[model samples]
Target chain A: MRPLDTAYMWDLVPVIASYVPLTLFMAIVAMAAALTLGSALAIVRVLRVPVLDRIVAVFISFFRGTPLLVQLFLFYFGLPQVVPAMTGIDGVTAAIIGLTLHFSAYMAESIRGAILGVDRSQWEAAQSIGMTQGQLLRRIILPQAARTAAPTLMNYFIDMIKSTSLAFTLGVTEMMGAAQKEAAGSFLYLEAFLVVALFYWVIVETLSVGQRRLESSLGKAVAR
Target chain B: MSCQIEITGLVKRFGDNTVLNGIDLCLEPGERVAIIGPSGTGKSTILRCLNWLDKPDQGTIRMGDVTVDAARATKAQILALRRRTGFVFQNYALFANKTARGNITEGLTTVRGWSAEKAQAKADDILTQIGLADRGDSFPAAMSGGQQQRVGIGRAMALDADLMLFDEPTSALDPEWVGEVLDLIRRIADGRQTMLIVTHEMQFAREIADRVVFMEGGRIVEQGPPAQIFGNPQDDRTRAFLRRVG
Candidate 1:
């Protein structure tokens, strides 16, 4: 009912800022984990490895088809209920697992496309030089695929950073969670939410700059 | 070790469309054979089949001490056969992500177990030999098509394979640049390293090939010394193909 409190909004900035590291930490770790696991899934799908290919296809379809919020709840709430040993899993851990699984499904497809985008002649050329399949993959295929997939992967990381807000529902006091708690005590929900949005905006803007720099450098490497 | 190549009944099919049908070929060590054929007559397929890049539906291929039965070759046998030969593709097929030197040295260090220093030394020599010594650090995307194909040939040469297979080496080059690539290939031919080249350049083939094999409809319709195939011409198909291309 009262006019929006400018002073209270200013005070919420540092409180939310204090939790930025935790948000970043969750996103960074999740991004790294997702990259490794996603690349493996991409390779499996590309190679169409026997039973594992079907299993990975199903896994990707489920994670991609479902909502991340639901998946987070399944990891944080449902898993512990079904599996007693998982009771000890904390909100942060659950969030990381959720982000890794959900984003990896999407990332796997991007990486798979990148791998396929590499010319078929590259494989033949590598083989003609006596390279083993492993050598061809590690030295030739993955490097090119990584370059092709970098910008998209960076976009996914930014998305994952923002998605870290959902971790608050599981009781982890990250940036959004901190803001929500700040608003609950002060009854200044708009101010708290505005500050949180600003923080995400700055972080994403900074990353977009980095993404452009990376793409330009890669472009230069290939430029005539 | 001798690097003779003997292929018998090499048949390749893509579902109902057969690309290579019951081909037989023989090459004594150091022979330079140019395979000239119409598009889709399977000249490229023959080169690919030799390396098991395209698995022949039915065939037996022997290179040096390695023999591969296309239908049932073991993984080790296929690898062994591939190791004995190098292939230069039509489109230059240089690794886009690597510099010219990296493309040359990758197989040496990774597959042949050469130390980094040794591989670099060998690569440097190959770069110079291919007339791209200054472009060793340049990526394929940064080079002209001719330069990229030179790097492709350099990458193959760095492997020290006894046999080389070229599938239209200069076909993808610009008209002006094609001469430089063909010149480099001619130099390699003079070295007598044993080669099977599938090419469209009649003049280059006449200059470099000891033997010329004319293929049509997935079969070697005629083959003999370059003088006979180019000048005399035994089969009507060979005469017609040469007439069309020349």
Candidate 2:
């Protein structure tokens, strides 16, 4: 409040950077788990697999409709009270679970749209070659869908990286949490928050570059 | 190593609209049959039904040891039936994401369980046969329509299918590209590969088909040897259709 502390902000960069790995670690793990689970949910929705399809629909609806913060609290605090087995789970685990469930709901729709976007002729071509449904999906459909979904999925991963900031609410000392603690101890809230924000900006910008390169490569593959 | 095909009482409908009605057909091994018809007259539907791509509401299709009852074919039976056949789509439905060779090799490796080395070798041979040896690495989007269609044919041919069903193989081609695709089909016909082709090219059909069938209103109006059908048509409908097409 007195004045912006430039020297303290520069010093706070490394302190915040130390926690970047933890933040990235959470995001990476959550992204991987979300993609796997999301793909399964997408396939289920695409195929309309009886009762499981309805269950997945409900899961997607509930997770997408609710707030991620409430979901995190539910997983971290409410879960232990209701489920005895969850009582032993730590804050990091709860945050990861929340991120995966929340993001997977969004990711499932992206993947499903991508799968649907593949030309109908591709299905016919694969079937004409004697592929069973599973074989068609594995050998042909999923590969193409993954390509179409890649840019969107990459964007989702970037979003998840930023969303990892919310893990601080669960008391995990990721980048944002580290910044909060540093600011509280030194009364340099502006400097500490600014450093953490820069960390996220750099990470997102790097990923944006990667996303563009990925899209152009895919474009080349399909370019006339 | 070819097999005859017998299709009886084949019926297909989309909602209340019948696309095929009581179609009965028999093909001697290595016969080249061309189905000619108006756009909505079910010629393409018949070809699609042959491969079970568009399931028939009622009928039986017999190809060698595989007999699929339209009403009762299990998944395994359908797969078995399809394994013996190949389909060339109107739009040159080569896998868009794969190179020309990849499209050919995918079925070989994934369905037939051929080793990658064997599939690649076969795919290379097919690419050369289709006159696209240098374009094996080109994706469909990068190729001209004629080249893409040729690659599509090569993909089917690589399967060594006992029966090939071409659903308007050149219908989607530019006028300039049509001749090359027809020429390729002619070469395949010369090899005596059993084929059922749905086409609008009257001259090409006359030259390549052993038997020519004229279909309308979801029914075959007449079917005979190409010479008889083209030179001395007995059915008024066939004569009218041939004249219109011409």
Task: Give per-residue CA lDDT, model 2, range B166-217, as digits (tens).
Answer: 9999889999999899989999999999999999888989999999999999
Tens digits of per-residue lDDT, candidate 2, A100-174, equal 999999999999999999888989999999988898888778988998889889989999999999989988999
TM-score of each: 0.95, 0.95
Where does candidate 1 stray beyond 4 Å?
A: B1-3
Clashing pairs in 1: none
What's the lDDT for residue B16 in model 1? 94
Tell me how far candidate 2 lies from the true structure as C-alpha RMSD in angstroms.
Answer: 1.9
**Residue-level lDDT tens digits of model 1 in A74-113:** 9998999989999999999999999999999999999999
